[model samples]
Target: MIIVIDGLNRHRFGAVLDEMYRLRARVFGDRLGWDVDIRDGKEIDQFDHLDPAYVVGLDDEGHVVAAVRALQTTGPHMLADVFNAILDGEPPIRSATMWESTRFCVDTKRLGRGRDRHSVSYATCELMIGSLEFARRSGIRDIVTVIDPVMDRVLKRSDNAPYGYVGKTAPMGKVPALAALLDCTQERIGRVRDFAGIAHDVFLTEDAALDLFARGHTSVEIETAAHAASANNDTRPLSALERYFVEQMSAARTSDEVQAVIDLIDALPGTLTPEQKFALKQAPAALAREA
Candidate 1:
């Protein structure tokens, strides 16, 4: 299923974004040999800092199988900055009705590229359907993509070929890359759906998407998230224990009490998310003691 995440509200979907970034790191940095920034197993860049939208494809188990990022052309974007060499002196195509889509990738390491409905091809097409549908609703007329030749074939094979090219293909890392434009009309969306045999809605409601992730969330964690969201005035949501930890730490009169609270949070079951791990790492005394 496709779960759409607003860049500004990403903290609410931390696990989904975390999986997407890891998938991007693996696909672009390790597999494709792309020149990119990968830190702590996440492939992220300056564009992620901007309030761009993300169309994420999640498997039944809530893992990110595919993803595509969209940024407005009027603002700082990759085609105008990073992939300028592809333009070859032609002016950057910036339009209010057009957005730029980049980082289009699938979990090739997990889903082998087979023609079956359960393969990477389905995941790729699912991501495409989600992207175009999102663009259409947001009043975007088209999207320009910085993609390699492999993606070009994927688009064509899915019966959703780009209308035109912006510039000549140039070597981007290990693959030849260029800019191509795809319309965000229903016609394009329908073509992709017909090709992929997906007639149901691609976009999942926020509550529905969160429920899917909640399957992986422990009851303690979910209860924590709910209470945290209620008490915190800040836009960011905190887990239940995180809020309780803050409350206890605020009342503690001694450093040892704070260390004890840290140790308690670090003892939760299932698995520690990267955020939780980082939080535990910040408590030097607790970390050293645990080590």
Candidate 2:
């Protein structure tokens, strides 16, 4: 299934986001030898902090297997900033109704080279469908993507080629890349759906996603328990809502992860300080806002 992670609700899907970053590292850095910064096994950059929406594909195990980042063209984006050379002297495309999709990749190591539903074909189409569907719903009229030649061919083979393109192909990092434009419409979504033979909804609710990560004792719970048990006896047990908040942070591996959980906690009525919440993985509240 697919999970949409945005700036507002990223905290709820911290682990899945981490998995997406790691997958990008594996695909672009380890396998494709792309020139990207890989620190601590994650290929993250300034754009990631720009509050772009992420369309992530998760396998049956709730691990991130595919993902694409979406950023509004009116502001800083990969092509406008990093790959401005690819424009070949043409003005960078910038508009409010147009969004930019980048960092498109799938987990080839786990899915292999097969063409079946479990393979890259299905996941790639699903990411396309998710992006189109999401953009259409968000009042976005078009999508501009910066992708390598390999991905361009994959799109054509899947019968979901870009509706149009911009500029000429240029050497981007280790691969030749270019800008392609896709319309955000039902027609595009239907084409990808038919090609992938996917008739079911591809999105999963947050709770369902968390449950699928593990049957019980989520990593957050495990971590919190380990620390709480060693704390002074005066500490009180967490409320039911508080426990749920912490459980969602099990996949977090950094201060950002901890802060994401803190953002959600801020929505819930609580007296928890940032320090207290970080120490115990206690969400500084409950899940109530939209992501």
Candidate 3:
């Protein structure tokens, strides 16, 4: 029962807003002792509202749990605005088919407490797949993010490395931090796996990152370089028809609405190639089908 909501509308966005803040506070404030304000048990920053992001996750009853804030390079965001220092004056951040991944998290309590083994980890992977698919459909190919070194190591091992400079070690309360870029390709997408047995503390390192990259994952550097050169320039954004379909899907209020939107997307011309169409149509159904 994973849900993905588009836009920043209050209702959907608000659903997990508090949860996100609480998680961040627990991780950064309480666990790491960051200076984040926890007045109402929420950790929020000024940059949260600048981009169009997605929130994905499951509810308490064995549901998927996830959320992401996506922003393009055209807007005021980390890559172009805040994190420029890390990029070392690289090409002036301008327009590109790039999306930043932000505020991603999974519910800790629901992680390993059920019959489903690695439920939380698998849900996290599913959320990434769904979000990557959505980004591809929306015309984005590069993803930028600041991840925990351990998670960065896992991504590198998974072959999802980015093509840019790794940022200087910053103090995330007590833990270290690094920034990276990732190339979102079908090949890389296929290699995404569950974060099982990842050593939570010892995850980020050049060796670990390379191990992941050697497996076919590109580093953030590669993603950034490709983006800088516009290597995949010919990639197409979603057609107007596809956009309409997604809008309809996002607005769907019932199971019937969901099926109707899926059907309409399936029928749209050029929305997906034949093979991709089969995968897209079957994925959601394989996991949870109704109606």
Candidate 4:
């Protein structure tokens, strides 16, 4: 089962530390040839100790098949902290609501298996949603992350166009890594589609097209405006938390009132089970119509 645990006590974290280390060693140490010392199969770094980070993935019997780590941009731990000189004037990431996602890894042995891949994908989406929820509560409206070029295309297809600026070309060895940003708002959430329209610049490059498929970017042809309309018009059903948020949004008569509703939703619990959390993240707009 794919589970997302927050406030992970050090013991539970220690249980999976080896799996994380081996994963990093396999992907970064050996595959990418990063200068990481794989001591006793554990990857440790200063940022891992300083940041209030969370780990999301599965513990199948005894092996960890997938994992991703997230960190807030509050102190010396921001991505800009390490890459400041490389970025153009620090990129203003401190002023934005952002989460730096790093060390994403999946077990290569689990690739051909059906359930394992699904679990990994689901856990990843839940982590992203949880990060957005955390940002909302903290008064951060934007999310920024440096992803592998392939992963960046996956995110673009999973949502509508990203909301912020893309920086000038930066090196990712031979291929370039893009700095993509998203607005984690209810309206923007509603705008998310499984595929970007062909008219968008994303579909113009052969490399981009290949990367999209390689990363398993699920394709849904629905346009963003049409998806939002469908979500707004559908009044079929909703969960209790969904009903509560929907009614609050319906009662909102002004911009401030709408924002208040958003704030309330953002401040709600961030540690929900993956399934319940996805429902919570998607429910407000779907249920608001019924109210």
Candidate 5:
């Protein structure tokens, strides 16, 4: 599912954002050979600090699979700042109704380039639909994105091709990049939705996101998270424990790792609150009953 993280709820999604950054570091720096700064395995740039809106995609298990960043054109966006070369001699297009979309990437290792529900194609199109819908709702009329030629083709195949080009393509890092424009219109959003066979809402609530991450945490980590949650404000969107659980669970790949989480939850009845207990035990209990 897609989650839009901005300055408003950014604090609640620190771990999620961190994973997205690491994914970018892998895609742009390691795989694509981009000249991006990778400090501590995160690809964070100056624009990330400008309170840009991030449309992040998460799988059923709440692991970040794809993401794209959107920044207001009136501000110091990438088109004007980092990728001015793409604009050639023309001045940067700055307007209140326009936004610059960049850092579009997906986890190629996790998702193969197929049309399956879990493939990179589905994730990529879902992100496109989510980002465009988000921009349209936020009163944005257009988006000028700096993307490589491969991505430009992906957009066309997905039926969400850019309406126009802003400037000539320029050599950027290991590949050439150009600025492409997309109008934030319902027609465009509908085409992508049809292409992806996604009729339901693609957005996930913050609470729903928390619940998914809450499912796979190991018992010891659960106890630690529970303790941490107890110290924080009740009104916080997500507690430290939940965040920690998400970080750990996202990395869990083996059956033993999953069983470790299940075993821990099974053993921790006396420690967790009634609400926490219910949330943590419901899924496992249902599966056990079915078995």
Candidate 6:
């Protein structure tokens, strides 16, 4: 399924975005050898800081499989600011109803090449459908994307060919790039849906998405636990028993897991600080409510 992450809901989907960025690093930095900024195993750029919306795809396992970034054309965007070279001598297209779509990618390692639900084709089409539908709902009229010739061909094959081109293609990084325009219309979306044979809703609820990641003790939970466990620089280190309890809580996905930690803590009293004891006591109830 898909999830739209923006500045409004970014905090709740930290783990998902982290995986998406890592996938981008793998695709754009390592595999494609693109001149992109990759730091701490994440491919991020100034556009990411501008509160752009991200249409991200997730597999059955809740892992991030595909993603694309959407930025409003009226403000600073990739094509206007960073990729102006692709625009040649023409002025950048800026409109209140248009958006710039970029960073479109899929996880080829986890997804296969067929048209199955677990294949790259399905994910790609799903992403296209989800993004187009989302843009249409958000009052966006068109999308201008900076993509390579391979992506251009893929768009054509998927029945999502751009309606027009902005400027001449220019050399960018290791390959040539051009700006292509696509209108956010139901006919365009229907063509992609028919090609992919998808009839269900592609978007996932925020809680549902979080639940899927919780099964694996996602990195977001780990990071949250780390922050709580080390809030004081002058505090003494956590005991082995304390550390064990914290680890268990951090990895707890179900009420049963949280209850087990609580039972263990009760059996061995005074093993944790008062604050830690309170937090552990609250874990079971929180997990129960989530369930």
Against the true structure, whose lDDT is highest?
6
Q: Provide the global lDDT of candidate 1 against the true structure.
A: 0.79
- Best model per TM-score: 6
Over 4 Å off in model 1, which ranges?
A: 113-117, 217-291
Better model by TM-score: candidate 2 vs candidate 4:
2
After superposition, which runs of candidate 5 have C-alpha atoms over 4 Å from their true positions? 216-291
TM per candidate: 0.75, 0.75, 0.57, 0.53, 0.76, 0.80
**Sliding window of 10 residues with minimal summed lDDT for model 4:** 195-204
- The local distance difference test score of model 2 is 0.77
Across 182-287, the per-residue lDDT of candidate 2 in tens digits comes to: 8888877887888889888888887676667543335544545534643353466665655565566654545666577667767655665544455554331222
lDDT tens readout by residue for model 5, 129-194: 999999999999999999999999999999999999987999888899999999999999999999
Steric clash pairs (candidate 2)? 220-250, 265-284, 265-285
Candidate 6 segments whose C-alpha is farther than 4 A from its true place: 217-291
Off by over 4 Å in 3: 8-13, 32-37, 59-64, 89-92, 113-118, 163-167, 193-291
Where model 2 places Cα greater than 4 Å from the true spot, the runs are 215-291
lDDT of each: 0.79, 0.77, 0.53, 0.49, 0.79, 0.84
User: Could you give candidate 1's per-residue lDDT for residues 55-133 as a string of tens digits?
Assistant: 9987776668899999999988999999999999999888999999999989886787666655898898889999999
Give the lDDT of residue 109 in candidate 6.
Answer: 95
Give the Cα error of residue 236 in candidate 6, in Å. 26
Better of 1 and 4 by lDDT: 1
User: Better model by lDDT, 5 or 6?
Assistant: 6
Q: Over the stretch 10-88, how does candidate 6's per-residue lDDT look in tens digits?
A: 9777767888999999988987778999999999999999999999998888888999999998989988898898888
Residue 56's lDDT within candidate 4 is 39
